[model samples]
Target: MQLDRIDYALLDALRKNARLPNKTLAEKVGVAPSTALERVRRLRESGMIQGYHAEIDPQALGIGLQAMISVRLERHARTDVAAFDTYLKTLPEVLSFWHVAGGNDFLVHVAVRDSQRLRDFALDAFTTRKEVAHIETNLIFSFQRNARLPAPPRD
Candidate 1:
């Protein structure tokens, strides 16, 4: 959907903090509470706002280590890829996974309790899979997320 200045302003305010009260949000975007409510509803219905999420610290959940595992598959058939994707979804350690181009077919992000768990996770998750041709694991020291997205160019 084409977004006007009000839409962009509402998105910017929400992106920074989704918990902002409706009154505060309306104030920030220079709109009346009811208009802000209706506009946000429209945005959601249009799928502009997919969902809101809370950022949680991995360490707080007893996750001491996190790593990205690059996986190269031996086969590129649809069935093989789909099966692998389904398998990744079942893994509790997997934070997220991306199917992408390049040398690797997939990038799997995971979190575990310690280095041993990380090693075990890699071996069990990737090395055992027959379709997996190669796997590379990289430790993540720190992570950060951008507060807001760049504004989309106006038509």
Candidate 2:
């Protein structure tokens, strides 16, 4: 589905604050509340709009330290990979992980209480795993997010 200026406006506005009221969203996008609601529903049905979520601060939740881990798996076999992927979900400290291209198999983002726990986690989690070949860790002293998408391509 082709998105017009109004659709782009709605997307930008909603991503900035998903909790925008129908009336407010309509005004911001220069449309009637009903139209805005209908457009949003269509966006969801078309898979343009995925889902809405609140942005929670890790620090506010008492997670003080954050790190990014580059993981190289020893084996690329499906079973080995599946087992490793399954094991990752069981780690509470892991925030997110992505299977990517390049020198590493996966990039994992984790948040913990401090450096000591991070070291322990690295050893107990990846270092001890047989399928894990190597790990490169980077400490994150700060983090930021801008969920806003760039302007849509001009067609």
| Top-scoring candidate (TM-score) | 1
TM-score of each: 0.95, 0.93
Cα lDDT of model 2 by residue, 40-123, tens digit: 999999999999987878889888999999999998888888898899999999999998879999999999998999999999
Record all residue pairs in model 2 with backbone atoms less than 3 Å apart, i.e. clashing: none
Q: Write the per-residue lDDT of candidate 1 for residues 1-155, one digit (tens) a residue.
A: 77888999999999999999999999999999999999999999999999999888889999989999999999999888999999999999999999999999999999999999998888988899988999999999998888887967967
Pairs clashing within candidate 1: none
Task: Pick out the ten consecutive residues of candidate 1 with the lowest summed lDDT.
Answer: 146-155
Q: How much does candidate 2 score in TM-score? A: 0.93
As a whole number from 0 to 100, the lDDT of residue 45 in candidate 2 is 100
Error of 2 at 34 (Å): 0.9
Can you give the lDDT of residue 54 in candidate 1?
88
- Cα deviation at 50, candidate 2, in Å, is 2.2
Per-residue lDDT of 105 in model 2: 92
